[model samples]
Target: MNKFGVLSILMVLISVLMFFILRGPNADLPLIIIILGSLSLLGIIFAVISKKWLSGVIGVLSNGAVLVCVFFILLAYGIAG
Candidate 1:
């Protein structure tokens, strides 16, 4: 895989780890959410620019999943709506 692909995968892993870490109380939820959003957005961009098909697709899916989960989590807390 290329540099972008590696970066994309790294972002994916970080986002997932952050998502789980933010699940607890008193964890600065809003800031964590924003960070996660930005990280996933970066992952998506890296994935789009990646030259490898496998990494590109995996990065897109993983990052997209994080974004969707974050959206729903915000909605559940009435923070998005």
Candidate 2:
């Protein structure tokens, strides 16, 4: 894969790991939103500041995946707990 492909895959992997690894009684909606939103914002910043289109593409794609994960996490939280 190319640079953007690698970065996008890595970002998605890391995001999922973070979601699963940080379970807590603090599984509250507010905390989840804060953390995920902040991370997404950071990704946006990285994309904006990147020197290449590859990096920007990776950032945008990764941000999308992160949003998906956030939705799933919120869904899980709503249905079961």
Q: Which pairs clash in the backbone of model 1?
A: none
**Candidate 1 per-residue C-alpha lDDT over 1-81 given as tens digits, one digit per residue, 9 for 90 to 100:** 899999998998998888787777656767777989999999999999996899999999999998998787767667533
Instruction: Assess each prediction's global lDDT (C-alpha) against the native.
Output: 0.86, 0.67
- Name the best candidate (by TM-score): 1
* lDDT of the structure predicted as candidate 1: 0.86
**In model 2, where do residues sit more than 4 Å from their true spots?**
1-14, 24-26, 71-81
Off-target runs (Cα >4 Å) in candidate 1 are 79-81
- Cα RMSD for candidates in order: 2.1, 4.4
**Per-residue lDDT tens digits of candidate 2, residues 1-81?**
345444544555666666677767666675765677667656656665664677677777788778877777778777877
Q: What lDDT does candidate 2 reach at residue 59?
A: 79
| lDDT comparing candidate 2 with the true structure | 0.67
Per model, how many backbone clashes are there?
0, 0
